[model samples]
Target: MSSPVLKPAAELASTNRTRHPNESADYRRARQALLVEEIELRRQIERVAELRRALPEGGEVTKAYVFEGERGQAAFAELFGDRQTLVVYSYMFGAQREQPCPMCTSFMSTWEAKLPDIEQRVAFAFVARSPIARLIAAKKARGWTRHKIYSDTAGDYTRDYVSAVDADMPGYSVFTKRGGRIRHFWSGEMGMDTADPGQDPRGAPDMDPLWTILDTTPEGRGNDWYPKLGY
Candidate 1:
């Protein structure tokens, strides 16, 4: 049987379900217009995801990147842990910094609760420049139990995949070990350099749901506000 064709998002959005009684006609008209754009935005998100999935196979990784984790020293290949795909989040916790980047920490906090579900399909690990003990201490302090945290004590992985100068930066990278060969799949390359005017550089389909939720409010993520380490 042939698949059924779907109506355009704009057409579907035109049939908006409900409206606030207190709202003015001007508000409803503007909201309907916004709904159309929101529908287009949703479509754009799917298109981008499709393009990401269609990307060509990335370069193979030959280096035996070792990391210090709860299991002591482990090679990069061990990170996959039976999964074909591995996701490594390079945290901005370099040796010089006493604490981790608040932005990175905020994003990490969201993953803590969803790690189990996410790990079902792919291996996920967070790497930092601090020692294993320090990483553990922070993890304990933050009450992060699900994430398999690690320390890149040697700085080899950070320098190669994260920052050339080993600068404190947050990065997200995915690797795939298919057909008995491991290769770099993708990474969040956007940063300050790619940010638009009055906007912070962030990955599409943002990893953190905090921003997504705030975006739905009237006061969208403002320029002055940012996630903090503590209240």
Candidate 2:
């Protein structure tokens, strides 16, 4: 069946804006033009998400990897709990680093509050290279109560999925189970090579909503500013 015709987003965006009493004609025109681009950007975001959802089946997860959790060690498959899908965020807090990556911590703080809603669909967990006890301590220090935290103490999962060289890098991977077999689904692969000029290599749909919210403000994410472990 053919899709129904709809009004162009730009045209729709142009029609409903209310003018402010103190704004000048120039400001009004500029705002209207920006609105058109904003509408187009929204359309592009949806298009990208559609493509992501339609991706083909990924490789089978044949190796039985295990990780350390607060309740002791657990098999990789067990991380999914009762859910069919699992999202693993490989945080950059390895044995070599004294502190966790502040950027990763910042992004995760947002997820803490969103766990209840997110777990209703897919299971989510944060995996790091630190020992299970250390990871738990950091969770407590961060005041996060909802996220499922784990440790790749042996670095097997980290080397296999995040970095073969065991580099201290943040990574995100998703997996799903079907017919009693687990398979890779998707991952945030965007990095320094895919980054735009003068911008940090970041995955689009930017996993962290912090940057997204900041982008909407008058002063966008600055070139030098980055989240620190402590203020």
Instruction: Give the top-scoring candidate (lDDT).
Output: 1
User: lDDT tens digits, residues 1-231, model 1?
Assistant: 553676787798888977887999999888888888888898789889878888999999988889999879999999999999999999888778898889889889998879999989999999999998888988888999998999999999999899999999888999999988999999988889888888988878887899999999989988889998899
lDDT of 2 by residue, 44-120 (tens): 88889878888999899988788999999899999999999999999988888888889999989988778999999
- Candidate 1 lDDT at 164 equals 93
Clashes of each: 0, 0
Once fitted onto the true fold, the runs of candidate 2 whose alpha carbons sit more than 4 angstroms away are 1-4
Write out the backbone clash pairs for model 1: none
Per-candidate TM-score against the hidden true structure = 0.95, 0.96
lDDT of 1 at 190: 86
Write down the TM-score for model 1: 0.95
Q: Where is the poorest 10-residue window by lDDT in model 1?
A: 1-10
